[model samples]
Structure formats: C-alpha cells, structure tokens
Target: MADKIRVLLAEDEPSLAFIIKESLETRDFLVSIYGDGEEALAGYRKDSPQILILDVMMPKKDGFTLAKEIRLSDRNTPIIFLTAKSQTSDVVEGFQHGGNDYLKKPFSMEELIVRVHALLNRLELPVNHKEGIAIGQYVFNYTRQSLKFNEEEEQLTHREAEVLLHLYKSRNEVVDKSVLLKELWGDDDFFSGRSLDVFITKLRKKLTKDDKVLIVNSRGYGYKLLC
Candidate 1:
C-alpha cells in the first residue's frame, strides 16, 4: 500500500486538534497533533512531515515565528496557518512569513480537506516550476511577488500579490466577496468583507495602469477580473 501523507498539526486547542487529527486520519492521512508551537517545532525536527498545519496563537512559539524559523531551513514544505485572527494585516503577515494557505477558526472539516488537497496539488507540480499568470498585457509572477507590464515592474506586497493572483485565476467569473474574504482573511464576517472591499479597490488602482484590465464589481455579489 502507498504511504499516507504525513501531517504535523500544531493547535493549542486540544479538542480542535483532536477533531482535525481524527478527520485527517479518516481520510488516510497520518497526522501528529501538538498543543503548542514549541513542541510542534520540536516534533517537526524529530520527524519531518509532508505538510504542517499550524495555529497562529500558541502557548510557546507562535505560528508566524515557527513558520519563519522553518522557512530559514526548509523552504519546500507547505505550511498552512490556522488562526482566529482574520485581519488583512494578519493574513499578509502569514504569507510573508512563508504560509501557503490560511484558514480561520470555526472552519468546517470539508473545507480543511479541500485546502489540504489544493496545496498538495501545487506541490505535485514539477520542481522549480513557477507560474506567471497573465492579466491583460501584464504578467503577474506569484513566486517573485511582482507584476510586470512592458518594461515596468511593480513589486507587490504579499497580500496584494495573493489577492490579484486569485482574481486573475477567476478572470471573467464573479468571484464571490465571501470567497475572497474566506480565502484571504480566513473569514467572511462583516469586518473581513469590508477589508475585502479595500483590497479590491487597491487592486483596481494598481491594475488601472493597464487600460484593458478592469476589476469589475458585481453589486451585491462579487468581483470579476475583466481583461
């Protein structure tokens, strides 16, 4: 039989971690759960896992600090940040520090499974492969966090790059406001919805440099990238 995908989960909440661990196990994933960041990091060093699921707040080391530390040594392992803090700044910080995905608290097990698979699918791509998504005449390089148009290049903040990339991926389709809020801020609450609006406005301003590119709003529904 094929070996199960090994997962290291670091969540301070015992019950939550237990639930997550059991769910992953039922999916045929081998999971090791830890209640603190320090112990989780230690566990990581002891037995390297295919992926890491970390909570932002923990008793010892925080997830951001832990992810930063791990990035210094191992840059390839996918790290998913789990947190209740759904602020835009917090989300950006997680990506800047090497998080591949973020999930807000009170998330469903099904969503967790989908995210895990999505990340693992990316990892399955050829080594050293980088995707530069095209937006009008501009090419957005996600790995370098840069957007290029002709000879000019704009370096995007981690959050900006992520938001733009997602919109570009859903080009011509209305990406629900809640989707962006949940995917980026990790929540679809009122505050996150407001933050999503700010991000969309910011992206619109930046992409306005290209006449053919427009981020269209769907009134009460969502936003779409029309190129």
Candidate 2:
C-alpha cells in the first residue's frame, strides 16, 4: 500500500494543534505535532514530512526564521504559515522567507484541508513544462515555480506560481481581481483582496528587468498582464 502523506505541524496552541491534527488524520494524513519552531526544525530533518504547517509565533524560533532556514537546503517542500499578524507587510515577509502559502488564525478546518490537498496535488501532478512559456524576455517554469530572465532567475512561492500561471493563461486580457481571489484564495473578502495586491506587487518587482512586462491594475476592477 502507498505510504500516508506526512505532515509536520508546529504550533504552540494545544487546542488548535489538536484540531488540525485530528482533522488531517481523518483524511488519512499522518501528522506530527511540534510545539516550537526549534523542535519542528529538528523533526523536519529527522522525519522529512511531505508538507509543513508552521505557526508564525512559537517559542525558540519564529515561522519566518524557520522557513528561511529550511529553504537553505530544501526548496521544493511546500510551507504554509499560520499567522495572527494583520499587517500586509508581515504577510510579505512570510512569502519572502520561503513560505508557499498562509492561513490566518481562526481559519476553517475545511479550508485548511483543501489547501493541503491543493499543494499535494501540485507536487504529484505531471511535469508542467520542459521549456517553459515565454513572457516578454522571461521564461516562466510553472512546475519549478521559477521565472528566468537572461542570467537572473526569480524563484516564486507556490502561491506566486499559481497566480502567475493564471495571468499567463489569459495574458494581455483583463483578469478580474475578484476572480483571482475567489479561485486562488477561496474568497474575495477584504483581507483576501489585500493579499492578492501584495502578490501582484511582488510579481511586478520580479519582472522589472523587462519594461515590456507589466501587470496593470484596472482601476478597482481587475488586472491585465501586458507582455
């Protein structure tokens, strides 16, 4: 039989952690819980979980630090940060530090489960590209989550890759902001809308090497990727 999908979860709150573990277990996932970032790091090295869910605030080390450290050696494993931070800058930091996705505190178990399945499905899917799609002077490798421009390359988080792929599919046309939020984030609430803006800002910076590439905002409506 196939091995159960392993999940390494690090969160200090026992009640929340328990709920997450129990929920994932019900779906046939094997979850190992750690109460601190340091412990989680050690556990990750020893057990090699297929995915990681880390709380942003934990003893010994924070989620951003843990993610950055893990990324020094491992880049493919998906990471989802659980944050209570409300600031947009905090979310940006999480993404910059190698987190592929995030869940705000008080998130639904169903949503968490769905995100888990989505990330795992991405890992299991067949290779997306051998050559990659061209966007202006850049080559986007969806499977690798990378965008290359000449000698430089921008490594994208899972969320960023997914966002870029959606825009790429409908390049030069306006893709409604609400559609992006609903499709990628499961809702178009205020928080989700702000998060989407943050991602677009990051993507724009990465593609700045070529002036021909632009992710244009459509005046409170949507965005158009002109390349």
CA RMSD of each candidate after superposition: 4.3, 2.9
lDDT of 2: 0.88
Question: Tens-digit lDDT track for model 1 on 1-227?
Answer: 99999999999888999999999999999999888889998999987999999999998899999999997777668789998996778977887788877888889999998888876765553333257667888888766667888889887755676677778777899998887777665568886677567767877787877898999889889889899
Which 10 successive residues of model 1 have the least lDDT summed?
A: 121-130
Candidate 2: give the clashing pairs: none
User: Where does model 2 exceed 4 Å of error?
Assistant: 124-126, 157-159, 208-214
Best by the TM-score measure: 2
TM-score computed on alpha carbons, candidate 2: 0.81
User: Which candidate leads the pack in lDDT?
Assistant: 2
Score residue 153 of candidate 1 by CA lDDT.
Answer: 89
Q: Which whole-number lDDT from 0 to 100 does residue 225 have in model 1? A: 89
